[model samples]
Target: MSRDCTDYRDIFLNDRPMMDARAPIEFAHGAFPGVVNLPLMNDREREQVGTCYKQHGQQAAIALGERLVSAEVREQRIQGWVEFARAHPDGYLYCFRGGLRSQIVQQWIKEEGGIDYPRVGGGYKAMRTFLLETIDHAVAECDMVLLGGMTGTGKTELLVQLSNGLDLEGHANHRGSSFGKRATGQPTNIDFENRLAVDVLKKRVGGIQQFVLEDESRVVGSCALPLPLYRGMQVAPMVWLEDSLEQRVERILQDYVINLHAEFVAVHGEQGFALYAERLIASLNNIQRRLGGERHQRMFLQMEEALVEQARSGSVEQFRDWISVLLREYYDPMYAFQREKKGGRIEFAGERGAVLEYLRERVNQRV
Candidate 1:
């Protein structure tokens, strides 16, 4: 049993423990930080109960729920709550809303295990609403500097190294390219927004003078940036990282070829290399219309040649040649167009080391 009142501010500000007593399906879709799902009912049970609630009224629904969840089943759920509460004395439980579900769990834990576990103030929906609003509030208040570069200029690398960096792509779980798909799917839009909001709020609390971000188009994988943040990025000044074609090609080979291949193997094991070849071709095919017929066909052959050599020699150096061609004929032209579109917005440009050094100075001076 909880005290009379719980503050939402303390939950967000103090990094408290959270237990989500929603169904597995609900947790799988999305939930907030430190939220462990210990459902009061499983998915099918919840669905059935929900249907009963709609068809009959509250009393009828409650009667059906009691019939369905046997005493043994109820005891097991209480035991789960007891175990969790024993481990985390300060943790709170939440359901879809801060309502009957949490209260029921609270009662069960109290009677069965003699332990007290509080339910969150407003539960998932209310907490979710708070996070969603917090995003725009933080973005509006904070200053921003966007980094602009074509693929493989080490922009993502520099962003991680910098003090105030906000890696949006990392949060979204995508690389933001035609071939940028992760083996795992992107989080639901709700999850993406939650992660972004929490991160922005953290930086705001830390008193970041300028939030450093990589320039991203609206979509990363299937997750689209919220319109407000995207609009802010459009107006924000950008710093471009200038690296030589050879250097850029090397970086591409490491990321797209070597690192991607390793990740594939880690995920899929023996079948990974074959699947990697297929994905690379499919990725190139995805951009085929933009690449044009002849160029696309040529690059496809180049990729095949590179992969064959790589498999034979256990070296991905061969990917560099094809990558170099793509950089010149494909990526450079595309990036140039975007740069031209935002001509006045590019405030600084330098090679990787110089650009990083400059950013370090900027971060220090802000203090």
Candidate 2:
């Protein structure tokens, strides 16, 4: 008789470890916490099996997979399962749909290694559904505080100070701005949402009374915020961070240019540094219509000069020339106009210290 399957809920609520049996390519696109990729068939082997299924049939594909993965190769695969099972005896192993690949692995492990781990009941699809639902639940359960400010007002920094902060940008690994893409690319959309859901779960467990989120658009980098949370941010209590233009310029300089170049250069070489500079220009150009044609052209030229100066020297001091202008002519006016749309939701506005104190006091009031 077949064993009963382990479901997604069991894995999630227990925070169970999982061994993903999909190829590295599939795992790279999306994966959750408490999971590690240990493929049954690697990328090339998976491709060959896929071709077999397409040209021949399911049984032939199974035959091809078995033949290709036999001998010492088969022992190597089984050893990974044994080691993981020894580490996480309660963990479940899963593939894309709890199908043939999962079954073959399970049977192989039991026969060769004497471990009989079950697969996830509905596999990746079901677990993904659970995470999406988990996000919806978090939105409904918590009161929220949304941060607002002109660009470079240190809103994300304040999020770190708050006990209940949920930095969606941190989760997405983007700055939630045109210039925010990292040298490391953003997560796949599925993984992004999964990470967000995990963050929500963490805050919930910590007794968060009013979780804080940054002012953001419908999307961050390559991932869109889940609908319920995005909508919740729109109507939540709003607090603005107030800082002078000089401070904003300094902050943006630190973030956008001064502190950013080395990592990209180290990773992708001269080509990488050039690409990073190019992205800076592109981000400025992206707001052209709003910046107006003349101001936009001037801003582009300014950034070009700054980059050239940085290339000559070892510092990015000139980048601030463009930074100061972008803040004054572009970001501040845009934020002022946008703030009008939030209506009466603005509850407080203050400097960085005051805002942090206020958020701490609010957390105390909750207690």
Q: Pick the candidate with the highest TM-score.
A: 1
* Model 1 Cα lDDT, one tens digit per residue, 1-367: 4662366656777777888899999998889866789999899889998998899977887788899999899878888888998888877888888887888888888887788778886788888888877777766877778999877898898899987899988989888888787665688877888888887777777777578899998988888888888888989988898887878888888878888888888899999899888889999999999999999988998899989987888877677777887889988998999989987998789988888887777777764
Give the TM-scores of the predictions, in the order they appear.
0.94, 0.88
Candidate 2: misplaced stretches above 4 Å? Answer: 1-16, 43-61, 68-72, 87-90, 269-272
Per-residue lDDT over 1-367 for candidate 2, one digit per residue giving the tens place of the 0 to 100 score: 1363655555666678889999999999899875899999999999999999999999999899989887898889889988887788788888888787778878877887787777787777777887898788878877888889999998999898888898888888898887887777888888899988877766676677578889899999888998898999888988888999888888888887865686678778878778778778878878888888998888889888888888878677777787888878777778999788874898888999998888778777874
As a whole number from 0 to 100, the lDDT of residue 320 in candidate 2 is: 79
Report the Cα lDDT for residue 153, model 1: 90
Clashing pairs in 1: none
Worst 10 residues of 2 by lDDT: 1-10
lDDT for model 2: 0.83
